[model samples]
Target: MTVLLIALGAALGAPLRYLTDRAVQARHGSPFPWGTLTVNVAGSLLLGGLLAAPVDPAVTALVGTGFCGALTTWSTLSYETLRLARTGKRRLAYANAALSVAAGLGAAFLGYALVTALTG
Candidate 1:
């Protein structure tokens, strides 16, 4: 059941991630991968909130492991950063790496804090 739930969540998450990435990237019209960054930060925020909350293990598996795992793409970020560097957009590559890490962490922390405060 847990596995099925996870699969189901992933099925939903993957499509959502793709759609969101397309929409955000289309709007930004920048070489920087704003779409990947958006999804990663969003996933981190959601996972952090789910972890901080007193949710069931099944829910955690479904949302955190499955949804977030599917929503966030470390591989895509790595590839995009490398592509930017190779294409002589070294500055943008560096910025993308640094900003993604910083923003994802910040969003996660914020989510955790919000959930903790609300639950208390």
Candidate 2:
């Protein structure tokens, strides 16, 4: 049951991640990988919110583990950063790494705080 739920969530999240990444990348001409950053932060925020909420384990498994796990791509981030560096965009590569971590953490904290405040 939990597995099925997780699979279902991943099925939705994977395509959503791809589409969202493409859409966001299309809007920005920078090769800084805005798309990857957006999805990672968004996934972190959503996972934080879902975890903070008084929800069931199944819900967590489905959305938190499955959806967020699929939505955020650490491998892509790594690859893109390497690509940037190799392509002579070293500054952008470093910025991408720094900003991704900082923003993802910030978004997660924000989501957790927001949910906690609202629930309380």
Candidate 3:
């Protein structure tokens, strides 16, 4: 049952990630991989909320391990940053790294606070 739930969640998360990537790419083009950044931030917020909520283990596995895990692509972010550096966009690459780390952390904290307040 746990495996099944995780599989289902991963299936959903992967496609959602793809759609988000494409959407951001469509709007911003493939210069900096804004989509990956956006998705990672969003996934951080979602995972934070899930962690804050009093959810069961199975639900946690599904949403946090499977869904958010698949939805957030650190690999892609690394690749894109490397690509930027390789193409001589050193400043943009650094900015992307710094922004991703900082904003992802901030969003997660915000989500946690929101969930905590709601639950309290």
Candidate 4:
């Protein structure tokens, strides 16, 4: 049952992430990869919230491991950064790498803090 729930959550997360990335990229119209950045930060925030919540293990597995694991993609971010560097967008590549890591962490921390405030 846990496995099935995880799978179901991942199924929903993956396509949702894809569509979000596409939409954000379409709006941005640049190689900056705003789409991936958005998803990564958002996913981190969600996972952080779930971790702090008093939810069941199955719920954590589904939302944290399955959904967030698929939704937040380090691989894609790395690939995009590399592709940018390879294509001579060294400045943008560096900015993307730095900003994504920093902002993602901040977002996660904020989510955890929010949960703490509410639950405490």
Candidate 3: where is the Cα deviation over 4 Å?
A: none
Please give the CA lDDT of all the candidate structures: 0.94, 0.94, 0.92, 0.93
- In model 4, the worst 10-residue window by lDDT is 44-53
Question: What are the per-residue Cα lDDT tens digits for candidate 3 across 1-120?
Answer: 998889989999999999999998889755887899989999999988987999999999899988998999999999999999999999999999999999999989988999999997
Error of 1 at 114 (Å): 0.3
Q: In candidate 2, which residue pairs get closer than 3 Å at backbone N, Cα or C atoms, i.e. clash?
A: none
* Candidate 2 local lDDT, 1-120, one digit each (tens): 999989988998899999999999999989889999999999999988887899999999999888999999999999999999999999999999999999999999999999999997
Q: After superposition, how far is residue 53 of candidate 4 from its true place, in Å?
A: 0.5
Off by over 4 Å in 1: none
**10 residues in a row with least lDDT, candidate 3:** 25-34
Identify the runs in model 2 with alpha carbons over 4 angstroms from their true place: none
Cα misplacement distance, residue 48 of candidate 1 (Å): 0.7
Local error of candidate 1 at residue 93 (angstroms)? 0.4
* lDDT score for residue 86 of model 1: 100
Checking candidate 4 for backbone clashes, the offending pairs are: none
